[model samples]
Target: MLNIRLASSMVSGVAGELLAAEAQTHHLRSTCSTSVSTLSSLESELESLLSKTHAIDGVTNQISSLALDTRILSLNATIEAAHAGEAGAGFAVVANAVRDLSRETAKATSTIFDHLQAVLSAVDRVQKVHEQLREQMLELDRESGVLAVRVKEQGEIVSTAVRFVDEAIDAATTPCAQAQNAPPASDTYALAPADDDYALAPADDDYGLAPVGDDYGLAPVDDDYGLAPVDEDDPYALASDEADEPPDSESMDDPYALEAV
Candidate 1:
Protein backbone atom coordinates (compact mmCIF):
# COMPACT_ATOMS: atom_id res chain seq x y z
CA MET A 1 0.00 0.00 0.00
CA LEU A 2 2.78 2.40 0.83
CA ASN A 3 4.49 1.58 -2.40
CA ILE A 4 1.27 2.11 -4.31
CA ARG A 5 0.79 5.50 -2.71
CA LEU A 6 4.31 6.48 -3.56
CA ALA A 7 3.81 5.41 -7.11
CA SER A 8 0.66 7.46 -7.29
CA SER A 9 2.52 10.56 -6.12
CA MET A 10 5.35 9.99 -8.57
CA VAL A 11 2.95 9.51 -11.43
CA SER A 12 1.08 12.66 -10.49
CA GLY A 13 4.29 14.63 -10.54
CA VAL A 14 5.22 13.25 -13.90
CA ALA A 15 1.80 14.18 -15.25
CA GLY A 16 2.24 17.73 -14.05
CA GLU A 17 5.65 18.01 -15.63
CA LEU A 18 4.40 16.54 -18.85
CA LEU A 19 1.52 19.01 -18.97
CA ALA A 20 3.93 21.90 -18.56
CA ALA A 21 6.19 20.56 -21.26
CA GLU A 22 3.25 20.08 -23.61
CA ALA A 23 2.16 23.65 -23.09
CA GLN A 24 5.66 24.90 -23.79
CA THR A 25 5.92 22.84 -26.92
CA HIS A 26 2.60 24.20 -28.18
CA HIS A 27 3.76 27.73 -27.51
CA LEU A 28 7.00 27.15 -29.37
CA ARG A 29 5.12 25.76 -32.33
CA SER A 30 2.89 28.80 -32.42
CA THR A 31 5.88 31.12 -32.27
CA CYS A 32 7.58 29.33 -35.13
CA SER A 33 4.43 29.50 -37.25
CA THR A 34 4.13 33.23 -36.62
CA SER A 35 7.77 33.79 -37.50
CA VAL A 36 7.35 31.88 -40.73
CA SER A 37 4.33 33.96 -41.62
CA THR A 38 6.19 37.22 -40.91
CA LEU A 39 9.16 36.12 -42.96
CA SER A 40 6.88 35.17 -45.84
CA SER A 41 5.28 38.60 -45.73
CA LEU A 42 8.66 40.28 -45.67
CA GLU A 43 9.84 38.21 -48.62
CA SER A 44 6.75 39.06 -50.59
CA GLU A 45 7.25 42.77 -49.92
CA LEU A 46 10.87 42.51 -50.99
CA GLU A 47 9.83 40.81 -54.21
CA SER A 48 7.31 43.56 -54.88
CA LEU A 49 9.95 46.21 -54.25
CA LEU A 50 12.35 44.43 -56.61
CA SER A 51 9.67 44.31 -59.35
CA LYS A 52 8.93 48.03 -58.85
CA THR A 53 12.63 48.83 -59.04
CA HIS A 54 12.91 46.88 -62.32
CA ALA A 55 9.91 48.75 -63.64
CA ILE A 56 11.85 51.99 -63.06
CA ASP A 57 14.35 50.67 -65.65
CA GLY A 58 11.80 51.26 -68.43
CA VAL A 59 11.40 54.93 -67.34
CA THR A 60 15.19 55.38 -67.23
CA ASN A 61 15.55 53.87 -70.68
CA GLN A 62 12.84 56.21 -72.08
CA ILE A 63 14.66 59.20 -70.47
CA SER A 64 17.92 58.08 -72.06
CA SER A 65 16.22 57.73 -75.45
CA LEU A 66 14.68 61.21 -75.13
CA ALA A 67 18.06 62.66 -74.20
CA LEU A 68 19.66 61.07 -77.27
CA ASP A 69 16.88 62.41 -79.50
CA THR A 70 17.36 65.90 -78.01
CA ARG A 71 21.10 65.72 -78.74
CA ILE A 72 20.40 64.67 -82.30
CA LEU A 73 17.96 67.55 -82.80
CA SER A 74 20.54 69.97 -81.36
CA LEU A 75 23.11 68.62 -83.87
CA ASN A 76 20.67 69.19 -86.74
CA ALA A 77 20.03 72.75 -85.51
CA THR A 78 23.80 73.41 -85.37
CA ILE A 79 24.16 72.21 -88.95
CA GLU A 80 21.35 74.50 -90.12
CA ALA A 81 23.02 77.42 -88.31
CA ALA A 82 26.27 76.62 -90.07
CA HIS A 83 24.44 76.76 -93.41
CA ALA A 84 23.20 80.23 -92.46
CA GLY A 85 26.78 81.24 -91.61
CA GLU A 86 27.22 84.67 -89.75
CA ALA A 87 23.44 85.42 -89.78
CA GLY A 88 22.83 82.12 -87.65
CA ALA A 89 25.56 82.67 -85.02
CA GLY A 90 23.09 83.21 -82.13
CA PHE A 91 21.08 80.20 -83.31
CA ALA A 92 24.28 78.10 -83.31
CA VAL A 93 25.04 79.28 -79.76
CA VAL A 94 21.53 78.20 -78.66
CA ALA A 95 21.98 74.88 -80.40
CA ASN A 96 25.34 74.40 -78.65
CA ALA A 97 23.66 75.08 -75.24
CA VAL A 98 20.85 72.66 -76.05
CA ARG A 99 23.37 69.98 -77.01
CA ASP A 100 25.29 70.45 -73.75
CA LEU A 101 22.00 70.31 -71.79
CA SER A 102 21.07 67.04 -73.56
CA ARG A 103 24.50 65.59 -72.73
CA GLU A 104 24.04 66.48 -69.04
CA THR A 105 20.52 64.97 -69.03
CA ALA A 106 21.84 61.74 -70.54
CA LYS A 107 24.60 61.52 -67.91
CA ALA A 108 22.04 62.12 -65.11
CA THR A 109 19.69 59.44 -66.57
CA SER A 110 22.60 56.94 -66.74
CA THR A 111 23.52 57.64 -63.12
CA ILE A 112 19.86 57.15 -62.05
CA PHE A 113 19.65 53.90 -64.03
CA ASP A 114 22.83 52.59 -62.37
CA HIS A 115 21.45 53.47 -58.91
CA LEU A 116 18.15 51.78 -59.78
CA GLN A 117 20.01 48.66 -60.89
CA ALA A 118 21.92 48.61 -57.59
CA VAL A 119 18.64 48.97 -55.68
CA LEU A 120 17.13 46.12 -57.67
CA SER A 121 20.14 43.94 -56.94
CA ALA A 122 20.01 44.72 -53.22
CA VAL A 123 16.25 44.04 -53.12
CA ASP A 124 16.70 40.76 -54.94
CA ARG A 125 19.36 39.67 -52.46
CA VAL A 126 17.15 40.62 -49.56
CA GLN A 127 14.22 38.72 -51.07
CA LYS A 128 16.31 35.61 -51.54
CA VAL A 129 17.61 35.81 -48.00
CA HIS A 130 14.09 36.23 -46.67
CA GLU A 131 12.85 33.30 -48.71
CA GLN A 132 15.56 31.09 -47.30
CA LEU A 133 14.80 32.32 -43.80
CA ARG A 134 11.09 31.64 -44.37
CA GLU A 135 11.86 28.11 -45.45
CA GLN A 136 13.95 27.54 -42.35
CA MET A 137 11.19 28.95 -40.19
CA LEU A 138 8.69 26.64 -41.88
CA GLU A 139 10.90 23.68 -41.10
CA LEU A 140 11.24 24.80 -37.53
CA ASP A 141 7.48 25.23 -37.28
CA ARG A 142 6.87 21.71 -38.61
CA GLU A 143 9.35 20.23 -36.17
CA SER A 144 7.83 22.17 -33.35
CA GLY A 145 4.37 20.93 -34.30
CA VAL A 146 5.57 17.35 -34.30
CA LEU A 147 7.23 17.87 -30.96
CA ALA A 148 4.06 19.37 -29.57
CA VAL A 149 2.03 16.40 -30.75
CA ARG A 150 4.45 13.97 -29.18
CA VAL A 151 4.48 15.92 -25.99
CA LYS A 152 0.71 15.94 -25.91
CA GLU A 153 0.62 12.20 -26.42
CA GLN A 154 3.12 11.68 -23.66
CA GLY A 155 1.09 13.91 -21.40
CA GLU A 156 -1.99 11.81 -22.05
CA ILE A 157 -0.08 8.63 -21.27
CA VAL A 158 1.24 10.13 -18.08
CA SER A 159 -2.23 11.26 -17.13
CA THR A 160 -3.52 7.76 -17.69
CA ALA A 161 -0.72 6.37 -15.59
CA VAL A 162 -1.48 8.82 -12.84
CA ARG A 163 -5.14 7.83 -12.89
CA PHE A 164 -4.27 4.15 -12.78
CA VAL A 165 -1.94 4.71 -9.90
CA ASP A 166 -4.58 6.63 -8.04
CA GLU A 167 -7.09 3.84 -8.58
CA ALA A 168 -4.55 1.32 -7.38
CA ILE A 169 -3.88 3.35 -4.29
CA ASP A 170 -7.57 3.50 -3.57
CA ALA A 171 -7.97 -0.24 -4.10
CA ALA A 172 -4.95 -0.97 -1.93
CA THR A 173 -6.13 1.22 0.92
CA THR A 174 -9.85 0.39 0.87
CA PRO A 175 -9.61 -2.79 2.93
CA CYS A 176 -7.32 -1.10 5.38
CA ALA A 177 -9.72 1.76 5.79
CA GLN A 178 -12.59 -0.64 6.40
CA ALA A 179 -10.52 -2.57 8.91
CA GLN A 180 -9.65 0.60 10.73
CA ASN A 181 -13.27 1.66 10.85
CA ALA A 182 -14.58 -1.76 11.82
CA PRO A 183 -15.85 -2.75 15.27
CA PRO A 184 -13.45 -4.44 17.73
CA ALA A 185 -13.33 -8.20 18.51
CA SER A 186 -14.63 -7.61 22.03
CA ASP A 187 -17.71 -5.93 20.64
CA THR A 188 -18.42 -8.95 18.48
CA TYR A 189 -18.07 -11.22 21.50
CA ALA A 190 -20.48 -9.09 23.44
CA LEU A 191 -23.05 -9.28 20.72
CA ALA A 192 -22.80 -13.10 20.32
CA PRO A 193 -24.65 -15.71 22.38
CA ALA A 194 -23.04 -18.52 24.44
CA ASP A 195 -22.41 -21.85 22.70
CA ASP A 196 -24.50 -24.01 25.13
CA ASP A 197 -27.78 -23.42 26.90
CA TYR A 198 -25.79 -22.18 29.89
CA ALA A 199 -26.49 -19.15 32.00
CA LEU A 200 -24.78 -17.34 34.92
CA ALA A 201 -25.72 -18.10 38.53
CA PRO A 202 -28.21 -15.79 40.19
CA ALA A 203 -27.30 -13.56 43.12
CA ASP A 204 -27.36 -14.84 46.77
CA ASP A 205 -30.74 -13.20 47.36
CA ASP A 206 -32.31 -15.35 44.67
CA TYR A 207 -31.41 -18.52 46.65
CA GLY A 208 -33.52 -17.56 49.74
CA LEU A 209 -30.32 -17.34 51.85
CA ALA A 210 -30.35 -13.61 52.62
CA PRO A 211 -29.20 -12.57 56.13
CA VAL A 212 -31.90 -11.23 58.45
CA GLY A 213 -30.55 -8.57 60.84
CA ASP A 214 -26.99 -10.01 60.52
CA ASP A 215 -28.11 -13.51 61.85
CA TYR A 216 -28.34 -16.20 59.26
CA GLY A 217 -30.31 -19.37 60.28
CA LEU A 218 -27.55 -20.59 62.63
CA ALA A 219 -28.41 -20.65 66.45
CA PRO A 220 -25.98 -20.02 69.37
CA VAL A 221 -24.03 -23.02 70.69
CA ASP A 222 -25.29 -24.53 73.98
CA ASP A 223 -25.23 -27.76 76.08
CA ASP A 224 -26.74 -31.00 74.58
CA TYR A 225 -26.08 -29.56 71.09
CA GLY A 226 -29.56 -30.14 69.67
CA LEU A 227 -30.64 -29.56 66.10
CA ALA A 228 -31.05 -25.97 65.20
CA PRO A 229 -34.58 -24.63 65.30
CA VAL A 230 -36.07 -23.91 61.90
CA ASP A 231 -37.70 -20.63 61.06
CA GLU A 232 -41.43 -21.18 60.96
CA ASP A 233 -41.84 -18.54 58.24
CA ASP A 234 -39.31 -20.26 55.96
CA PRO A 235 -40.99 -22.03 53.03
CA TYR A 236 -38.24 -24.71 52.98
CA ALA A 237 -38.45 -25.57 56.76
CA LEU A 238 -39.14 -29.34 57.49
CA ALA A 239 -39.99 -29.17 61.27
CA SER A 240 -43.38 -27.90 62.58
CA ASP A 241 -45.26 -27.64 65.97
CA GLU A 242 -47.32 -30.83 65.24
CA ALA A 243 -44.26 -33.15 65.52
CA ASP A 244 -43.83 -32.38 69.22
CA GLU A 245 -47.49 -33.28 70.29
CA PRO A 246 -48.40 -36.72 72.02
CA PRO A 247 -50.67 -39.32 70.28
CA ASP A 248 -54.46 -39.12 70.80
CA SER A 249 -56.43 -41.64 72.91
CA GLU A 250 -58.04 -43.08 69.71
CA SER A 251 -54.67 -44.24 68.45
CA MET A 252 -54.12 -46.45 71.59
CA ASP A 253 -56.96 -48.81 70.45
CA ASP A 254 -55.29 -49.54 67.17
CA PRO A 255 -53.09 -52.67 67.23
CA TYR A 256 -50.35 -51.02 65.33
CA ALA A 257 -50.10 -48.14 67.84
CA LEU A 258 -50.68 -50.41 71.05
CA GLU A 259 -48.11 -53.08 70.04
CA ALA A 260 -50.08 -56.11 71.31
CA VAL A 261 -51.24 -54.60 74.57
Candidate 2:
Protein backbone atom coordinates (compact mmCIF):
# COMPACT_ATOMS: atom_id res chain seq x y z
CA MET A 1 0.00 0.00 0.00
CA LEU A 2 2.83 2.33 0.81
CA ASN A 3 4.38 1.56 -2.50
CA ILE A 4 1.08 2.17 -4.26
CA ARG A 5 0.66 5.51 -2.54
CA LEU A 6 4.19 6.47 -3.53
CA ALA A 7 3.47 5.55 -7.10
CA SER A 8 0.28 7.58 -7.05
CA SER A 9 2.13 10.58 -5.69
CA MET A 10 4.77 10.26 -8.36
CA VAL A 11 2.17 10.02 -11.07
CA SER A 12 0.35 13.06 -9.74
CA GLY A 13 3.60 14.98 -9.68
CA VAL A 14 4.32 13.99 -13.25
CA ALA A 15 0.85 15.03 -14.30
CA GLY A 16 1.33 18.41 -12.74
CA GLU A 17 4.66 18.82 -14.50
CA LEU A 18 3.11 17.79 -17.75
CA LEU A 19 0.34 20.30 -17.31
CA ALA A 20 2.90 23.03 -16.77
CA ALA A 21 4.76 21.92 -19.84
CA GLU A 22 1.55 21.91 -21.86
CA ALA A 23 0.80 25.43 -20.78
CA GLN A 24 4.29 26.51 -21.74
CA THR A 25 3.98 24.87 -25.10
CA HIS A 26 0.71 26.61 -25.74
CA HIS A 27 2.28 29.90 -24.83
CA LEU A 28 5.15 29.19 -27.18
CA ARG A 29 2.72 28.37 -29.94
CA SER A 30 0.90 31.60 -29.39
CA THR A 31 4.17 33.48 -29.45
CA CYS A 32 5.16 31.81 -32.64
CA SER A 33 1.81 32.63 -34.22
CA THR A 34 2.18 36.24 -33.26
CA SER A 35 5.69 36.36 -34.68
CA VAL A 36 4.45 34.80 -37.89
CA SER A 37 1.76 37.41 -38.16
CA THR A 38 4.25 40.21 -37.57
CA LEU A 39 6.55 38.78 -40.15
CA SER A 40 3.70 38.50 -42.64
CA SER A 41 2.80 42.14 -42.07
CA LEU A 42 6.41 43.15 -42.49
CA GLU A 43 6.64 41.15 -45.68
CA SER A 44 3.51 42.81 -47.04
CA GLU A 45 4.91 46.25 -46.25
CA LEU A 46 8.14 45.32 -47.98
CA GLU A 47 6.15 44.15 -51.01
CA SER A 48 4.30 47.43 -51.08
CA LEU A 49 7.57 49.31 -50.83
CA LEU A 50 8.94 47.23 -53.67
CA SER A 51 5.94 48.00 -55.80
CA LYS A 52 6.34 51.74 -55.07
CA THR A 53 10.04 51.47 -55.90
CA HIS A 54 9.19 49.85 -59.26
CA ALA A 55 6.76 52.69 -59.95
CA ILE A 56 9.65 55.07 -59.52
CA ASP A 57 11.39 53.23 -62.38
CA GLY A 58 8.65 54.44 -64.72
CA VAL A 59 9.14 58.05 -63.57
CA THR A 60 12.93 57.72 -64.04
CA ASN A 61 12.41 56.39 -67.59
CA GLN A 62 10.15 59.36 -68.35
CA ILE A 63 12.84 61.69 -67.07
CA SER A 64 15.45 59.93 -69.23
CA SER A 65 13.20 60.26 -72.30
CA LEU A 66 12.72 63.98 -71.63
CA ALA A 67 16.51 64.39 -71.30
CA LEU A 68 17.06 62.59 -74.61
CA ASP A 69 14.49 64.82 -76.38
CA THR A 70 16.16 67.92 -74.88
CA ARG A 71 19.58 66.72 -76.21
CA ILE A 72 18.09 66.18 -79.72
CA LEU A 73 16.47 69.66 -79.70
CA SER A 74 19.82 71.16 -78.62
CA LEU A 75 21.58 69.40 -81.58
CA ASN A 76 19.00 70.79 -84.04
CA ALA A 77 19.57 74.34 -82.61
CA THR A 78 23.39 73.92 -83.01
CA ILE A 79 22.99 72.79 -86.67
CA GLU A 80 20.75 75.74 -87.49
CA ALA A 81 23.25 78.08 -85.73
CA ALA A 82 26.06 76.62 -87.88
CA HIS A 83 23.99 77.23 -91.03
CA ALA A 84 23.76 80.94 -89.95
CA GLY A 85 27.46 81.38 -89.22
CA GLU A 86 28.82 84.22 -86.99
CA ALA A 87 25.24 85.58 -86.66
CA GLY A 88 24.27 82.47 -84.40
CA ALA A 89 27.60 81.90 -82.61
CA GLY A 90 26.02 82.85 -79.25
CA PHE A 91 23.01 80.52 -80.02
CA ALA A 92 25.45 77.68 -80.81
CA VAL A 93 27.27 78.29 -77.52
CA VAL A 94 23.88 78.31 -75.67
CA ALA A 95 22.84 75.15 -77.54
CA ASN A 96 26.08 73.44 -76.51
CA ALA A 97 25.46 74.48 -72.87
CA VAL A 98 21.85 73.13 -73.11
CA ARG A 99 23.10 69.80 -74.52
CA ASP A 100 25.69 69.58 -71.70
CA LEU A 101 22.89 70.24 -69.14
CA SER A 102 20.71 67.53 -70.75
CA ARG A 103 23.65 65.09 -70.74
CA GLU A 104 24.27 65.82 -66.99
CA THR A 105 20.52 65.35 -66.25
CA ALA A 106 20.53 62.00 -68.08
CA LYS A 107 23.61 60.85 -66.11
CA ALA A 108 21.95 61.89 -62.80
CA THR A 109 18.74 60.07 -63.81
CA SER A 110 20.71 56.91 -64.65
CA THR A 111 22.47 57.09 -61.28
CA ILE A 112 19.10 57.53 -59.48
CA PHE A 113 17.67 54.54 -61.42
CA ASP A 114 20.66 52.40 -60.44
CA HIS A 115 20.27 53.39 -56.77
CA LEU A 116 16.50 52.69 -56.98
CA GLN A 117 17.16 49.26 -58.48
CA ALA A 118 19.58 48.49 -55.65
CA VAL A 119 17.00 49.61 -53.09
CA LEU A 120 14.37 47.40 -54.77
CA SER A 121 16.73 44.46 -54.77
CA ALA A 122 17.53 44.94 -51.09
CA VAL A 123 13.83 45.23 -50.24
CA ASP A 124 13.06 42.09 -52.25
CA ARG A 125 15.77 40.15 -50.44
CA VAL A 126 14.49 41.38 -47.08
CA GLN A 127 10.96 40.40 -48.03
CA LYS A 128 12.08 36.93 -49.06
CA VAL A 129 13.97 36.57 -45.81
CA HIS A 130 10.90 37.60 -43.88
CA GLU A 131 8.84 35.11 -45.89
CA GLN A 132 11.21 32.31 -44.96
CA LEU A 133 11.20 33.42 -41.35
CA ARG A 134 7.43 33.53 -41.33
CA GLU A 135 7.27 30.01 -42.73
CA GLN A 136 9.66 28.80 -40.09
CA MET A 137 7.62 30.48 -37.37
CA LEU A 138 4.48 28.81 -38.66
CA GLU A 139 6.20 25.46 -38.61
CA LEU A 140 7.40 26.10 -35.09
CA ASP A 141 3.89 27.04 -34.05
CA ARG A 142 2.50 23.83 -35.49
CA GLU A 143 5.15 21.78 -33.74
CA SER A 144 4.42 23.53 -30.47
CA GLY A 145 0.73 22.82 -30.87
CA VAL A 146 1.47 19.16 -31.50
CA LEU A 147 3.71 19.07 -28.46
CA ALA A 148 1.06 20.67 -26.31
CA VAL A 149 -1.52 18.18 -27.40
CA ARG A 150 0.72 15.21 -26.72
CA VAL A 151 1.65 16.63 -23.37
CA LYS A 152 -2.00 17.02 -22.52
CA GLU A 153 -2.66 13.45 -23.51
CA GLN A 154 0.25 12.19 -21.48
CA GLY A 155 -0.90 14.26 -18.52
CA GLU A 156 -4.35 12.78 -18.75
CA ILE A 157 -2.88 9.30 -18.88
CA VAL A 158 -0.78 10.02 -15.84
CA SER A 159 -3.79 11.44 -14.06
CA THR A 160 -5.74 8.32 -14.87
CA ALA A 161 -2.91 6.19 -13.57
CA VAL A 162 -2.82 8.20 -10.39
CA ARG A 163 -6.54 7.78 -9.91
CA PHE A 164 -6.29 4.04 -10.46
CA VAL A 165 -3.46 3.81 -7.99
CA ASP A 166 -5.47 5.77 -5.46
CA GLU A 167 -8.42 3.48 -6.01
CA ALA A 168 -6.21 0.45 -5.63
CA ILE A 169 -4.86 1.81 -2.40
CA ASP A 170 -8.39 2.41 -1.20
CA ALA A 171 -9.46 -1.05 -2.21
CA ALA A 172 -6.49 -2.61 -0.50
CA THR A 173 -7.05 -0.70 2.73
CA THR A 174 -10.85 -0.93 2.89
CA PRO A 175 -11.03 -4.38 4.47
CA CYS A 176 -8.40 -3.54 7.05
CA ALA A 177 -10.10 -0.28 7.87
CA GLN A 178 -13.42 -2.05 8.24
CA ALA A 179 -11.85 -4.69 10.42
CA GLN A 180 -10.34 -2.06 12.66
CA ASN A 181 -13.68 -0.32 12.95
CA ALA A 182 -15.70 -3.51 13.15
CA PRO A 183 -17.31 -4.78 16.37
CA PRO A 184 -15.52 -7.62 18.13
CA ALA A 185 -16.74 -11.22 17.96
CA SER A 186 -18.12 -10.94 21.48
CA ASP A 187 -20.21 -7.97 20.46
CA THR A 188 -21.10 -8.71 16.88
CA TYR A 189 -21.84 -12.42 17.25
CA ALA A 190 -22.48 -14.38 20.40
CA LEU A 191 -20.20 -17.35 21.27
CA ALA A 192 -21.53 -17.84 24.80
CA PRO A 193 -25.17 -17.84 26.10
CA ALA A 194 -26.57 -14.52 27.22
CA ASP A 195 -27.59 -13.88 30.85
CA ASP A 196 -31.24 -13.58 29.81
CA ASP A 197 -31.07 -16.78 27.80
CA TYR A 198 -29.52 -19.08 30.40
CA ALA A 199 -30.53 -20.02 33.99
CA LEU A 200 -28.38 -21.50 36.74
CA ALA A 201 -29.43 -24.75 38.41
CA PRO A 202 -31.39 -24.20 41.70
CA ALA A 203 -29.68 -25.37 44.90
CA ASP A 204 -32.80 -27.44 45.93
CA ASP A 205 -33.01 -29.29 42.59
CA ASP A 206 -30.31 -31.77 41.55
CA TYR A 207 -29.58 -32.14 37.88
CA GLY A 208 -29.51 -36.00 38.05
CA LEU A 209 -28.03 -37.04 41.37
CA ALA A 210 -29.62 -36.83 44.88
CA PRO A 211 -29.41 -33.54 46.78
CA VAL A 212 -26.63 -32.92 49.27
CA GLY A 213 -27.02 -33.97 53.05
CA ASP A 214 -27.87 -37.34 54.60
CA ASP A 215 -24.82 -38.59 52.65
CA TYR A 216 -26.65 -37.71 49.44
CA GLY A 217 -29.54 -40.09 50.53
CA LEU A 218 -27.20 -43.10 50.84
CA ALA A 219 -27.54 -45.60 53.73
CA PRO A 220 -25.28 -45.17 56.74
CA VAL A 221 -21.98 -46.97 56.24
CA ASP A 222 -21.96 -48.15 59.86
CA ASP A 223 -25.30 -49.87 59.57
CA ASP A 224 -24.99 -51.04 55.97
CA TYR A 225 -21.33 -52.11 55.92
CA GLY A 226 -20.45 -52.36 59.66
CA LEU A 227 -18.32 -49.19 59.39
CA ALA A 228 -18.34 -46.42 61.94
CA PRO A 229 -19.25 -42.85 60.96
CA VAL A 230 -16.36 -40.69 59.81
CA ASP A 231 -15.25 -38.07 62.30
CA GLU A 232 -16.76 -34.74 61.31
CA ASP A 233 -13.92 -32.85 62.94
CA ASP A 234 -11.10 -34.75 61.14
CA PRO A 235 -11.09 -34.40 57.36
CA TYR A 236 -8.93 -37.52 56.78
CA ALA A 237 -10.39 -39.97 59.40
CA LEU A 238 -11.04 -43.55 58.39
CA ALA A 239 -14.42 -45.10 59.21
CA SER A 240 -14.47 -47.90 61.82
CA ASP A 241 -16.73 -49.16 64.65
CA GLU A 242 -13.76 -49.31 67.03
CA ALA A 243 -10.05 -48.82 66.65
CA ASP A 244 -9.40 -52.58 67.27
CA GLU A 245 -12.78 -54.10 66.21
CA PRO A 246 -12.45 -56.97 63.81
CA PRO A 247 -14.71 -57.06 60.76
CA ASP A 248 -17.50 -59.63 60.50
CA SER A 249 -17.66 -62.03 57.59
CA GLU A 250 -20.38 -60.02 55.91
CA SER A 251 -18.38 -56.83 56.32
CA MET A 252 -15.38 -58.69 54.84
CA ASP A 253 -17.53 -59.74 51.98
CA ASP A 254 -18.99 -56.23 51.60
CA PRO A 255 -17.44 -54.33 48.69
CA TYR A 256 -18.08 -50.98 50.39
CA ALA A 257 -16.20 -52.01 53.54
CA LEU A 258 -12.60 -50.91 54.15
CA GLU A 259 -10.37 -53.34 56.10
CA ALA A 260 -7.39 -52.13 58.04
CA VAL A 261 -4.10 -53.44 56.74
| TM-score leader | 1
In the range 1-261, model 2's lDDT, one tens digit per residue, is 787888888888998999999889989988998898888788778988988999999899999999999999999999999999999999999999999999999999999999998998899789778878888898898899889889999988998888888889989999999999988663333233333234233333433344323344343344343443354344234554344455556555655556644
lDDT of candidate 1 at residue 210, scale 0 to 100: 37
For each candidate, give its TM-score against the true structure: 0.68, 0.68
Candidate that scores best on lDDT: 2
What Cα-based lDDT does every candidate model obtain? Answer: 0.73, 0.78
Could you tell me which residue pairs clash in candidate 2? none
What does candidate 1's lDDT look like per residue over 1-261, in tens digits? Answer: 777777778888888998898888888888988888888778778878877887888899999999999999999999999999999999999999999999999999999999998998888788778878888888888888888888889889988888888887788788999999999754322322232223222332233333422244443433232222233234233322333433344543444442211
Displacement of the residue 216 alpha carbon in candidate 2, Å:
15
Where in model 2 is the C-alpha error above 4 Å?
A: 174-261
The per-candidate count of clashes, in order, stands at 0, 0
